[model samples]
Target: MESVALNPATLSGPVWVVAPHPDDEALGCGALLAALVAQGTEVWALLLTDGGFSHPGSRTYPRVRLAALRLEEWRRGLQVLGISPERSAALGLPDGALAAVPPEQVTAAVRRAFQLAPPALVLLPWQRDPHPDHRAAWEPVRAAWNTPVLGYSVWLTGRGAAADWPVAAEAQVLTFDVTPHRRTKAAAIAAHRSQLGLIQDDPSGFTLSAEMVDRALTGPELYFRPYGQSVD
Candidate 1:
C-alpha cells in the first residue's frame, strides 16, 4: 500500500483535531499536531467526552472529580502541542457512551465548536478505529463540518478487525513521520497522568498499556482521507 508522506507545511491554518476522550488526540495524532503547530498552523482541539468513565471504580476520584482532572490533563497536553486553552473546547458529553447521545445534539455541539475558527482541515478518529466512542464520533463530526478530514488511527493498529481498515477505494492513505517531533509527542502523551496509571483505586479502570503507548510513540502515524476530499 503506497502512501503519500504528509508535510505539515502544506496544510492550511485553523485545523481542528477532534478527540472522543481526553487522551485520544495525543495517542492518535499528537505527532502530527505537534508538527502542524511547529509549522505555524492554527490548531484547535475539540474534546467530545468528559473522560470520567475511565476511572469508574475509583473511590478516590469520583466521576465529577475525574472528569475535571482529565479536562485539565487534556489542556496541559494541548499546551505541550502549542495550543492555548482558549483554542480548545470540551463538549462534556458522556464518555464510552457517545453512541447513546442524540445525533443532532452531538452534531450541534461539534458545529458550535467549529464556528469560532472554522477548520481548513479536521483530524478525527478513524471510522472503524475499534473503539465504540471512536467509531461513533465519525458521523457527527462530518455532519458538523463538511470539509477535508484525515482520520487518525488510535486502536486500529492494535485492536481492529481486518475489515476495519480502509480499502483502496475508500480512502487515500497518508502517513506522517513522527521522528522529528517524537519528543514533543511523547510529552503530550505523558501529560495525561490518569491514563498512565495515576489512578490506583480502580481495579478495572482504564490505563494505557506500555505496548499501546510505545506503538503511539513509534513513527509514521496513519491517516485516511476519504475519497473525493483534498486536504490542501
Candidate 2:
C-alpha cells in the first residue's frame, strides 16, 4: 500500500461513524466529528459493542453493570463531540464477541442506521486494526454496503505495521487539523474514565496510560481510504 495525502474538512452531509467499542470513536476520530459538527454537518454514531469486557474478571463490576456504564460513557463522549443522543445508536452487541454475531444481525443494524440518516460517507474502524471487535464490525459492513468508507486506525499504527498495511499502492491517508477541536477530543476520550485506569479493582482491566492519550492528542486525526475513494 502506498500513501497519498487528503484533507478531512471537506466531508459533509449525513455522516455515519461506526465504532467497535465505546471510546474507539473518541480515540479514532473525535477531532473529525467535532470538525464536522462545527461545520453544520449532520453526523450519526453507530457503536457495535458495549465495551463491557475491558474489566473481564472484576467481581465489583458485573458484565451488565459495566455495559450500562460504558454506554453512558459513550453517550457522554459523543455529546462532547456535539452529537445529540437521538443521532447515535448503541446496538447492544456483546463486547468482544462481534465476530460471533449473526451476519444478518450486523447488517440489519447497519441498514437501520442508514435509514436513520443516510450517510454520504461511513467511517469505519481500519479493517486490520489488530482488534478483533474492530475487524468484526468492519467485515460485515464492507460486505453489506457499497458506500464510500474511510477507515480509521486505533491500534494498527500503535502495534507497528507490516508490509500489507495502508492497502498496497492505492492507499490515501486523510488528515484533519484538529487543533480547534483538540480540547473537545481530549474531553471526549477522558469521558471514558473506566478505560483510562479508573477501575481500581481489576488488576487485569485495560487502562490507557496518560502517555497514550497524550500521543493521540498530539497528532492530526487520520483515516485510510484503501482504494483511494473520495469521502465526499
Candidate 3:
C-alpha cells in the first residue's frame, strides 16, 4: 500500500488515543504520540481494559493486583510520551472479555471518558485489527464521539488477514517515521514490565518477544483515516 508521510505538525489536538490494553498504545503509536507532544499538541489517553487477563494463572499477581500494576504501567508509558496521568482515564473493563460486553455499555463508558477531555482527533485500533478486544473497541469509540479518527495498527502487521486491512477506497493510508523517536518509543514500550517478562510464575502468561519489540521499533507507524466521514 502506498502511504503518504504524516507530519505531526499538521495534526490537530487534543488527541485522544483509545487503547484496548495497557501496552497497545505504546506498541502501536508511541512515536506518533511523542511527536505530537513535541509539537506542543495536547495528547490524552483512554485505556479500555483493566489488563488483568494476561497472567490469569499467576497466584503472586492475582487479577486485582495485576490490574492495578498494569494501570500504573500504562500511566508511566503515557508520561514517557508526554501525556500526564491526569489526561488519561481507564474504564476498568474486563480484559479479554470485551467482545462479550454489551456495546451500549462500552459506548457509555467511552462517552464518560470523553467528557473528561474532549478530543479534536481520536486514535483507536483499526476496526478490523486481529485481536478480538481491539476489533471490538472500534464502534464504541466512534459512537462516543463523532470526531475525526485515525486507526492505528497494533497486531495488524503480524496477525492481520487480507480482509483486516483497510482498502484504498475505505481509508487514506498515512505513515509516520519512528526513526527519530525510536529511543523514546522503546522506553514507553518497556514501561510495561509485566508484559515484558516481569511475571515469572505463569508459564502460559503473555510476554512480548524480542522480535515483536524489534518490529515495532523499526517500522513506520501507520494510521488509517476512513474515507467519506464528516467530523463535527
The top-ranked prediction according to TM-score is 1
Local accuracy by lDDT, each model: 0.93, 0.83, 0.92
Q: Write the per-residue lDDT of candidate 2 for residues 1-232, one digit (tens) a residue.
A: 3344455567766888988899988988898888888888999998888888999988888888989999999999999999989999988898888989997889987787778877888999888888888878877876656678889878766764684256456567767666778899999999998898778889988998777687678766668886646776
Instruction: Estimate, for each residue in 1-232, the C-alpha lDDT of model 1 and write its tens digit.
Output: 6799888888897999999999899989899999888888899999999999998999999999999999999999999999999999999999999999998999999999999999999999999999999999999889998789999999999998889999889998889998888999999999999999899999899999999999998857999999998988
Of 2 and 3, the candidate ahead on lDDT is 3
Q: Sort the candidates on lDDT, descending order.
A: 1, 3, 2
Per-residue accuracy of model 3 over 83-195 as CA lDDT, tens digit each = 99899999999999998899999999999999887889999999998999998999988999878999999899888989999987999898989999999999999999999
CA shift of 103, model 3, Å: 0.8
Clashing pairs in 3: none
- The weakest ten consecutive residues by lDDT in model 2 span 1-10
Could you tell me which 10 consecutive residues in candidate 1 have the lowest summed lDDT? 1-10
- Give the candidates in order of TM-score, highest first: 1, 3, 2
Q: Each prediction's TM-score against the native?
A: 0.98, 0.93, 0.97
Sequence-dependent TM-score of model 1: 0.98
User: Which runs in model 1 stand beyond 4 Å of their true positions?
Assistant: none
